[model samples]
Structures are given as C-alpha cells and as structure tokens.
Target: MTDFLHLLHHELLLSLVIVCMLILKLADRGRSGSSWSNLLNVLLLINFAGGLLIEAEGSLFDGMFRSNALLHFEKNVLSLGLLLVGLLATPYLRNHKHSAEFHILIASTLLGMFFMLSAGHMLLFYVGLELATIPLAALAAFNLNRGESSEAGAKLILSSAFSSAFLLLGISFVYGTCGSLQFEQIALTVSGNPLQLLAFTLVFTGFAFKLSIVPFHFWTADVYQGAPIPVAAYLSVISKAAVTLVFISVLYSVFGALQATWTPYLLITALLTIITGNLFAMRQDNIKRFLAFSSIAQVGFILTGILGANVDSEGIVLYFLLIYLFSNLAAFGVAGLISAATGKESILDYRGLHASNPRLAWTLTIALFSLAGVPPTAGFFGKLFLLTSGASLGNYLFIGIAALNMVVSMYYYLRIVKAMFMETTAQPIGKIPTGVAPAIALALCIAGILVSGLSGSFYEHIHLLTLSY
Candidate 1:
C-alpha cells in the first residue's frame, strides 16, 4: 500500500483534492465565488507542491501504468501550467457564479491528462483521452448566456465524437494486427504492414483533431471566441500540451518502425499547418480567434520537432511547451483582464491602449514578442531548438520553410503590438485594474519569459530527465 501510494502520489493527491473540494461544496452550498476561487487556488498550489515532493520510478498494475523521472517532469510542468491558469483566471472567476465548478472541471480534465501521460496500454490511453476531452466541451459552452458558447459546445462535442470513433477504430485495428494492447508489446510487434499503417493513420487523425492541426482545426477559433477567457486559456495551453505529450510518446515509441512511412506525411502537414495558420491569423479581428490560429501554427512547429526522432527531441518539445505555457498564458491573461474590464475583444479596440493602460500594453507586447519567436525571449530559444532538432533529419528544406513561417507569424503577432503602442484611437481603452492574482500570474509569466531562455539549467534539467524515457 505504501509503495502504491508513493508511486501514484500525484494522482492520489489530485483525486483527493477533487473529492475534498466536492465535499466542501456540499458542506457549504452557498459559498461565494471569491471564497471558492481562493480555496481552489490554495488546493492547486498544494497539488503542485505535492507532485514535486512525491517522485517515484516504476511500473504498476502489471505494466498497465508506469512512472519515471520524465513522466513526472511532464506532469509537474502541466501542474505548474494549471496553477498559473488558476491564478491568472482568478480575477474573472471571483465574480462568476460557478467559480468552484469551473475549477473542478479544469482539475478533472487535468487528472485525465495525467492518466493519458502514464498509460502503458492503448485502452488506458483511450480512456484517459476521453476523460480529458469530454469536460472541455462543457467548458466551451460554459457561458450559458451566450448562444455562440452553445454553438462552440456543440461543435466540440461533434468533433470529439468523430475523433474518438477514429481513435477507437485505430486501436481496434492495432489490436487485431498485433494481438496486444500493451504499448511495449505493440512497440515490439508493430510492423509497416498495410493494416498497421492504416491503424496508425486513424490514430494520427484523432491526434490531429486534439492538437488543432490545420484541416482539423476549424472548431478552434469559434470555441476560443465563445468560451470564457479562462477556459480558452486552459484549452489553448493545458489541453494542447497534454495531447502533444501523448502524441510524441506514441509516435516515437509504438510507431517507431513506421518512421519511414510517416515522416513525409508529417512534413507535408507541418508545412501546411504553419502556412494555413499564419495566413488565417493575419485576417482575424477577434483576439481569441487570432490566438487560436496562432496556436495552430505553434503546433506545426511541434510536429516539425517530432520529426527529429533523436534522443533529445522529446526534451526539446517539452522545453518548448514550458515556454509556451508562459508565453501563451501571459497573452491570454492580459486579454482576459482587458475583456473583463472593458468588454472589448477586438484588436482595433486596443489601439492607443498604452496611453492609458501601459502596463497591460507592455505585458501583451512581451507576450507577443515571445510568441513570434523574437530573440531574447524563451520562445526564440524554444523554436530554435525545435527547428534545429527537426534539421537533424536532414530535411533542411522543410526546416527552412518552417523557419520562414516564423517571419509570417511575427507580422500578425506584431499587428496587435502595433495597435497597442503605435496606433491611436479616440476612445482608447482606459486604465484597467489588475487584481492581485492576475498581477502575480502576469509577473510570473514575464519572469519565465525573460529568465528561462537566458538560463541553460532549465533545458539541461529537462534533457537529463528525458534520458531515462
């Protein structure tokens, strides 16, 4: 029992937090939103801290589950991201009627992601994926007051249903071909046979839906525009990070034999996703939608990195995600503050924002700079490593294309910055109050952006952890 507890301490603790939060809700049914937000934030901090303290390395449940330094590191990075989300969203949540429920849903989805990361069996992974996805549809429609939110919810549900069907069908095909669901067994048995190839394609389609890869990304912008800012932030950062973690693991391990088969396909999709995302983002007026397409472009770079198949590829991807967590969330944090206070979501509304809201203007500027992969920001290093890793495959042409798309991304990202600092509007957004929680969140994100790139130790730590995986 003690061994089980030690090995699964992160999961156990998170589950306990969920249950305790539920019991508290039952015990005090009328608690205010601010009160609930405070409690949730404190519990999330504890959960993250507990994850750090309880590290174990082993397989359990007959290898249906596993753990190691690398998986632990992934979970910790996710926990930290969620912690930041919870903190950044506090300003919006404090007055929301269902603040406790919102955090609960986010936490539940995070638990699902945990299982997805640790699953040793295909069925376990599928189960975890479903758990992670279902709650998000509800979250997308969380703003019951808005019809667009309901539409976002419907679109997400339909998309998730189709993707899940494809995933299950693919898993079935793998089972039929290999006669086992265990990742290790399948990894050992998988071949580049026609059936296995078809199966991998189906599975890749499912991941494409989750990652918001080009064609499968139609629902993203609408969902982001409709959902509450916090939910949008969670979906953009936490959800994408989780899927990317599992996607890389499955591709690099279970489908290793099919590398020759998938590389060209991945290259094509990466190029298209980056180009398509950048082109679409330039035309978006809504901030959420713009970021949505921007995230799609970011995933393109991630797909490029996965082509490396080198030992350090996983660590590089993880490091990029860490940088993304800070950079993307900072952008959303500022947007949320502005939206909540001014009820403005248009890029044009931000014109001359610096004249009145200089702090937010600068925060968003730094975030945009990071997202555009501008130098001196962690994002620059993140993209450099990813592109470099992809270059290891000797596909310099593809890598070069991906690198050029970065310049395209910069134009759109800077459009927002230009509106904020350079352009002027007669009725520019006035000074908005930054609450304690959001202030801390934005400050942490800024610090992360500035300090992480300059410090080599963070990447070194991640690289060391990935050595075992």
Candidate 2:
C-alpha cells in the first residue's frame, strides 16, 4: 500500500500541475493578467525538476511502476527534451495570437509523456500514449484560421485513431491469448504460435505508425508541411522520443524471446524506411517536408541500434536518442526562430541566411552537419556505436546497407547546409530575440553534441544503463 501510494503520488503530482494550469487559465480568461508565458516557464521548470526528483526516488508500487537507474536516466533525458521543446516554443508563441493555450496544451502533453515513459503495464502504457497523442492533434491545428493547419490536425487525428484501433485490438488479442497484461506474464505465455505472431505484428504496426516507418509514414510529410513549426518540433522530438522509449521497453521486455521472430521484419523495415525516406527527402524544397522525410530516415538509423544483439543495445539506443533529440531540436529551433522572424518556412527562403543572420545560420549549419553524422559531434558517436553494435552482431549486410544509407542521407542533409552557406540572399534576414530560454536551449544542444563526443563516460554510462535492465 505504501509503495503504491508513492507511485500514485508521482502521477498525481503531474496531474495536479495540469489542473492548476487549467485553473489559472480560467482565472485569466477575459483579462490581460500576468503573462501566462512567464508563469508557464516557471511551472514547466518546476515540472521538470519534479520529474527528476521522482525519477531519483525510483520505482515504487511493487513491479507495477518500478523505476530503476535505467528508467530514471531515460525519464531525465525525456524531460530535457520536453524542456527544450518548451523553450523553443517560447519565441514562436510570442508572435502568434493563440500562444497561451498552445503552451498549456504542450504542458499537458508532456505530463502524459512523463507517465508513458514510466509505464509498467500495458494499460498504463496505452493510456499514457493516448494522453500524449490527443493534445498534439489539437496543437497541430492551433492556427485555427489556417486551412493547412486544420487539415494537418485532421490527418494526424485520423491516423492516430487508426493506429490506436490497431493497438487496442492487439492488446485484446494478447490478453485473450496470454490471460495477462503484465509484460512479464505475457512474455511467459508467448510461444512460437500463429496467435503470438499475429499479436506481435499487430502491435508492431501501431508502433511503426508512431515511429513513422515505411508503409505507415504517409502522414508525416503532410503534417510537417502544414503544422506550425513548434508543433512540428514537438512531434519530431518529444512525442516521438516518448513513443520510442515505450517501443524499446516493449521489445526488450515483453518480446525478448521472440527476437528471432521479429529481427528479420525489423531489419527489412529499417532498410525500406531508409531508402524511401531519403528518396523522398532529396526532392523536397519545403524545409518542413524535407525535415519530415529526414526524421523518417533518422528513425531507420535508430532501428539499427534496436536490432543489435548486444546486452548494451538499450542503453546505446537511448544515448543515440538523446543525441538525436538535441540535434533535431536545434535544427527545428533555428527553423522556428527564423520562421517567426520572417514569415518564411521554405528552404529557398534561406537564401543568403549566412549573410542576414550569421548566428542562426551557423547554429543551423552545425546542427545539420551533426545530423548528417559528421565527426566530433554527438550524432557521429551515436552512429558509430550503432554501427559497432550492428557489426558485432555479424550482420554485415545490415551494417553495409546502413552505411550506404548514411552516405545517401548526407546528400539531403548537406543540401540544407549548402543553402545556408553557399547561396546568396536577396534581402538581409532580420534577427529575432531568441530570448534567454531558447538561447540556453540551443547552447545546451550544441554542448551536448560536443560533450557526449568528447567524453567516453557518457557512452559508458549509457552502456551500463542498458545492461542494468
């Protein structure tokens, strides 16, 4: 009972924070009170701090919500991603009319994501997933007056509903077959049978939709193209990271025994996603659509880590994800910052960005290079570890194909860099005050890429975390 209460307390605390924010919104309605943005920043900081403390307190409640060193690390990593997203959204919201509600929705979504990361049962996982997802569709359409934004929202919701149906059906099948929803119990019941295979495939379909893998990724480009930059960043980083964490947990825990059954499928999916994403990205001139496809390609690289047979694969995946979170956010942060300053979101609008806003251009350049897996950055190390792990598994074909994909990916990623540096601008780009929050966030991302590369300890720590579980 004590343990359960402790676990409950953490969940309740996040819920309380959400409710408090709602009440504050109500009180501020019809009046220009203190800037909700300021309050939100403070509240978000506190929420992040609270999540850390809760993670440190570790798991409570029997095995129902156990938090160990690994999960604690993952929670902190995710919280950092959330914080960065919020900071990036600040300048974006400042210029928009409907800013406050947007921040509130993001906060609420982060609360759900926090729970999703620590979920110990299928029920909790599914609930957390939904809680994290539903708000995002609305956020996608926060620009209510824009037809593109509304269409993006509709698409996201429709696709999300489809995925949720698949997930629920899979859950029902698993429950019917295994007679239990707990990961351990389900794993115990799973055998090489048609029902188990069906359950696995069904669940994988839902997760693949979230991960934006091939065949399940048709909505990504349109949504990215239409949604506001901040919302797109939220989807790219926070939401995707949370889902990936759960996906890893599910793969490593519930389906560890079925590796032989699932590895080939995962391998095939990774290759397909890599090829398709890169091919589509190469032809995109719209920055958001380009990034949408780029993110899909990145997911393929992430899949390589999951396919690793090493004991440290989980930790490696998480560490790489952390690097990805920072690199991708920095890229989007620059885009959002630029978009807010100039009403331009297209790649060509960046003509002579280096001359107009050197700081933003250079920051974006570094971010792009990092994403392309250039050296002395966190992204490079992430790819190195993934490749190393894959090579160790003796999957030469997989490693070789991944290497080729990396080369292909560089072509598209470099296109953005080339546009910023080599191209000439027609007009001087105006600089917006990135503010303390976003500046700090960008700095941290840059620092993370550098620090993670310089320090072997970072990788070692991640290795330990993967092994701990």
> Whose TM-score is greatest here?
1
Global lDDT of model 1: 0.91
C-alpha lDDT values of all predictions: 0.91, 0.81
Q: lDDT per residue, candidate 1, 364-436, as tens digits?
A: 9999999999998999999999999999989888888899999989999999998988999889888899988
What TM-score should be assigned to candidate 1?
0.99
Which model scores highest in lDDT? Answer: 1
After superposing candidate 1, which stretches have Cα over 4 Å from the reference?
Answer: none
Backbone clash pairs for candidate 1 read none
RMSD per model, one decimal: 0.9, 2.0
Residue 331 lDDT, candidate 2, scale 0-100 = 95
In candidate 1, residue 170 scores what lDDT? 95
